[model samples]
Target: MTKLSPETILQHACIGVMGLDNNGIIQYINPRAQELLVCDTHNGISLDTIAPQIWKQVKTLIQQGMNEQAIHIQGPRGGIEMVVSPVDKKAKTSSDNFNGVVCFLRSHEKFESSAWQYPTIKEMHLQFQSLLDHSYYGIYIIDGNGIVLRVNDVAAGLIGMTKEEMVGMPIGELAEKGIVDQALSPAILKSKKPLTRPLYVVKSNKYIMASGMPIFDKKGDIRFVVVIEHDMTIVKELRDQLKHARQVADTIKNELSDRNLLELKSHEVIADSPAMNQLLTVLLKLAKMDASNILITGESGTGKGFLSKFVHQNGSRKDKPFISINCAALPDMLLEAELFGYEKGAFTGASNTGKAGLFELANNGTIFLDEIGDMPFPIQAKLLKCLDDGEIRRLGGTKSIKVDCIVIAATNHNLEKQVQQKKFRQDLYFRLNIFPVHIPPLRERREDILKICDFYLKRYNKAYNQKKRFSEKCIEQLQGYHFPGNVRELKNIIKNAVVIKENNVLDTVLPPGKNKAVPISPPCEETAAPPASKGLNEEILAFEREKLTQALNHCTSTRILADYLGVSQSTVVRKLKRHGLSVE
Candidate 1:
């Protein structure tokens, strides 16, 4: 018999694994289980005798050659989720003859408490009190009878009720009493199913967003309903701000009508550091090549989207279409339709005429998938197919459409870490990891901070028609700031500073002394005054080399050094080569 490839390595995994023959006799047991169960498969043991609750599900999955869902089984050592798939090394057909079952077990020690019994209110509270208390989202729970079994402090405070006052009160009674708005706990109880949201409750003039799920018993009967609620006070305020913004939106819209939005939106990267200079140089090189799939990784608001557009505009496909989509902005179904396009009548609300997808529209150009990490698993699989065959099959379409396009994906997520946790696919990660570029955070590339700040300052001044300027002390203070939000944050700070102040020197907003605690690095002098030890030219060259050496430790690549030195990247390369400097 052939050894299951994954199972051989999974054999030593901490989670127990067991194999059963077609006749329900144990043929193999991994080391973890051997120690736990105190038995070897040499002595055939029936799984039915060991875990009667799980054997039924296992037997069905093995016979069918696959299982779509994991089966959670409770045992002496808490609970373990079992995933079963057919072990076939050579079969080409989807149907594989089942010789034996290889079952992988995943431990669920903490989750076990929830999977098991909901004994008494006190026990329930004891089992989950710590979790509920520590969670930022308010937690409320009800029993099958709709009796409020538990309400954490956060939940109680949201409704102006104490745990004692809320407990034992039927949710229906509470809803009728109008203590808070109607709860979704009742819907979960009525349907005996999980629910995502409930009608907003108006208590203390605050709208509460609530969602819950119904827990079940061994017999699959409704046992308890747990809901998490969040106060949307700040969110409502932001919404109000949006409404006010719309009041002046028309003036801005009319102003933009005569201007090229893309041209206006386009921002030139400010590279006054080695890190950024090298990045810009490489970006241009990649743009010229224009065929390879590129992945840009960075923190949010670090100009990843901007860099991608820059690449497309500079590329061979500059005249062609450039399409972009945020993978996270739409739901899975909508995102899929938007990317691959769906045929007319494909679903209940699909377009009358099949709409062309971004991939098709971006043919011969570039398609930017922003926040690609949030893409749905199904879409990821389809994208892999498209990348492989250079053809995409629209939803409910029989024919595949060929597309010649550059795929550039950007994300703030650690895709490699996501793959390890099984949240992301390893194959897809490897495909995207090819030609990877990581944009450094603004804090790390501090040399570029002032340049970016000044760019935004000048632009905002032009837009607002105010000639406000930052004092030298203000610049120094800004440089000292950690700028945790990076360039994006710096831009906002500059805009706010200019708008709130009308004076020529908008310095007092930050207060020069506020950032004194953070050490300012010698006032960021690009070039120092000539020393008397040698002639001016020699002193300047010596100073330039010293700056390069100092920046070399902070800047990893030639591009960064070039940006830091305020020179063309080629010049930095030539200088480095002359100085016998080399990098991997």
Candidate 2:
């Protein structure tokens, strides 16, 4: 039998085959190789014309007599793996010492065997290096010690570092310097599984999404970690932009809704008592007129804020802003500045571009002045003027800005008593008294207790992740009890009960039986007796004044006062005149 030539042997090989020269030009390509590579060029084609990536790495390999285990080159139809081996031209012919390399190409997708054949170590290394260098993702190969062995161009560019600088660098050192956090790589090695984390590349000021997988050795121990990274900076920026856009849209929606019209509404207040239901009907009727100023009288934390919101939300100007401020919270000066915005530099540290006051912010809307009794005496006069004239001047500006805001003031104080004592202006008191809404205390509406209890119990159960039930005994006990804090107190009791009780019945968090509410305000001096003076006449007068004031509270009539004090009617009238008490 005639011995087969090298070309004949290669052409007959089962896998694809290619041979190149020292100048990186393709010398020979078998039918299998052409079919796998799908190259358009024939005999005279350079390796670069067929596959640029393979040419780039394979040329260096041939020059150094380096070989690769396997490499995957892509084409339109399929992917081919190339295993390279050095070709000895000197042994074949003396004319050339280095002919090039013979690459054995195999299609991964067209494998006939169930098990894959491992390529030689040299071929494997070249294949891996080629794939890693040209990948779009940033790739890092790390050893068990967390030292980077190799990196791709994409990875280096993300950190603003060259591959030369990163290779052999410890991942811990990179993290310490804020280049990219490789903490997940360590976890992958520990768990022998893949891990992913979002990282901020401080050096490049960009966000990266990184995933890492552990590569195990023969002993099933993690030998190295391969981390792949993708840029997420644009996605994060878009998310923030979306959040801000939603906020702006919500503001515009609120601004444009229900403008300048406060539609009449009934039963906005949550109430079951006859008094409350009747009061709500009247309140809605007055709100429909939209001409009268309103004064809401109720204890602190008695759903006053909720009622204020209801008034604004259900009224003609319901679509407009309902601005509320606590009159007692700030000092006189700060309250003035907040109520009426100052001109630029009106006071030390004032805003350079004068601010708009709550009243201004509430223009064409409703401004609820809370704790109105606590407002300073001077502000009260200015407030009265503003209410009467429909205009207000800033703290320092001479110009009075015309405003059409509806004023709704609320207080627990007895403004009628304040007016009689001269602490509150009489005219302002009368102006606010129009369409008065006097919310009854909880003790007067015992029927609402169970309804209010169920409402708050359901609310707090959802909040605290509880399903506590109120026993019949518990319900009766709560209903019988006087809630001085009213709706606010009931809400707190239920809230605490939900947290404390583990069983179906909430009996642990019930409040003490004492019904008196804690006083929200200090006693006005008008009710206090005159203090004793140094003189005998002053001491006698103080005693008389104390007796008269005490009597005045219960018995306003001189005839009744005389009967209660065991004194004559003329004597009672004489004492009333002397002490400046009314004797109607």
Candidate 3:
């Protein structure tokens, strides 16, 4: 006999051979298999992509760790036959040790002529014994006669019976005996197709999401039905919790409606622009009737914290405490302890007496979580639990304390992007984002600039006992500059202009990093004639550097400065480099 390599033997083999990993992803397909499958290149592709109909049955068999069985099918090319067998890695033939599968493919004509031996009764029983290894989902295999051929431990327990008791019993008997609320096998056999429904077992008092798939014989008659069930106990609990939360919200809204609400001042919400006016209208309604959680997002200094308090002070919790905490201010341990409270001996240097957390103190009120995007990952889970269960447990505490408070979280960071990057939890984001409010940056609403300036200017003048006012040039400069710090920065500019300068008509404010004030013309201001000594290009370059330098004061990064300058980040970088300037 001549020495034959495995590759050479595979190439010369009469039947097709294909290998698939546990996930049903094609690991390798011999040339013969590719020819039969009508695919020249089939490696590294999913088995489902090649043969969706056959893939489902093959998957079920792999999950069941059944014996090799020939599956006849009709493909696009012609009649085909596939025999799937699970490959066990360990010496013990069990599903837990099965890592992959080896498939044998052939034409239906050849398969019918061949005398392939079927698995014996002992071999079938040994293969069925591996069903107990699957712990995640309940699995059941009922034959065409509706008699249970195999039952995993999980499925047996779900029906309040032993595996041996469940095996050989007709599925219809389980329903008649009141072992299960209903059986999926009966419907699957009738439909001869896959179906999923919630199965309620009266014996265990558990709800299971049952999905049954039927396997058909060559004659198109149903051969077996595989039922896979997932436990829905947690889902049911979550739904109940959500219902309770809604009820609590309704109670709070009713309470607020019954009481007299305070009239809000116009200056408190500054909405001269249509965008602000629209946002304020929504906020007012949310504060009055809706008790849902709120999420306020904006750049830093855009008054997210102020809006959060505005909602609290104007809502049903107006008479109650309004506690606020910066999530990013404290270390991880301290933040958790502060938010959820801690036992006296929870950690080293602990308080002699156990402390009440912000959540406990803010009961029946609102707790504002600022910079929520910066919250630690481990703490996010606890926060989610509190929002869901309406309770919180102190560190090192045995019992969970009841705390009911509307959580309003604020973040300047792009939470969606952070979620994609796995830095923020998607569930927590969705929970706090029940009622979203975004405060547009001040530069976006230029009309509001003068209104805000007039309001703050008069207030600052009264506070300082001065009647100073902004000159025409000063007003123009304020409107033209990009307010990177939003309303907060604009207010400070007006205040500084009123209090610091001796001139009654302030023409210029002191620029950042300069002791002396610098005159800043608005973008719309007519260009001043350049000195005769300077060329046009030189003058334009100089003007660009000056604007870039001033914008850099309010911005910490090139990305922000680019947005303010209305230019691409690359353009900003190139300009900065040309002018010998950087963000720092």
TM-scores for candidates 1 onward, in order: 0.43, 0.43, 0.44
Worst 10 residues of 3 by lDDT: 517-526
| Collision count for each candidate, in order | 13, 15, 0
lDDT of 3 by residue, 190-277 (tens): 8898999997888888888999999999999999998888889789989999999999999997566433222343445565788876
> Model 2, poorest ten-residue lDDT window?
258-267
lDDT of 1 by residue, 1-584 (tens): 96668767766677677777766778777887654444454538797777666778777765555633487776666666776655552431333466666677666764365556656755876767788887788898888899988788888887777889988988886577776666577778888877775344555666678888889999988888888889786787888999889867977875563243234333676767788767766777788787568999886557788889888987889999999887865568888889999899888898899888899999998999987887878889999889889999889888999999999999877899888888778888888778889888776778987788778889988999889888887788777776545566677678778888868897654534555625532211123222356587677777777777887887777666655654434346556655666443
Per-residue lDDT tens digits of candidate 2, residues 419-524? 8988888999998888788887776777777777887787778887889889877876777665556676677778778878778686545655433233332322
Candidate 2: RMSD to truth: 22.8
lDDT of each: 0.74, 0.75, 0.80
lDDT for 313 in candidate 2 is 67
Give the candidate order by descending lDDT. Answer: 3, 2, 1
> Which candidate number would show the highest TM-score if scored against the true structure?
3
| lDDT accuracy of residue 63 in candidate 1 | 59
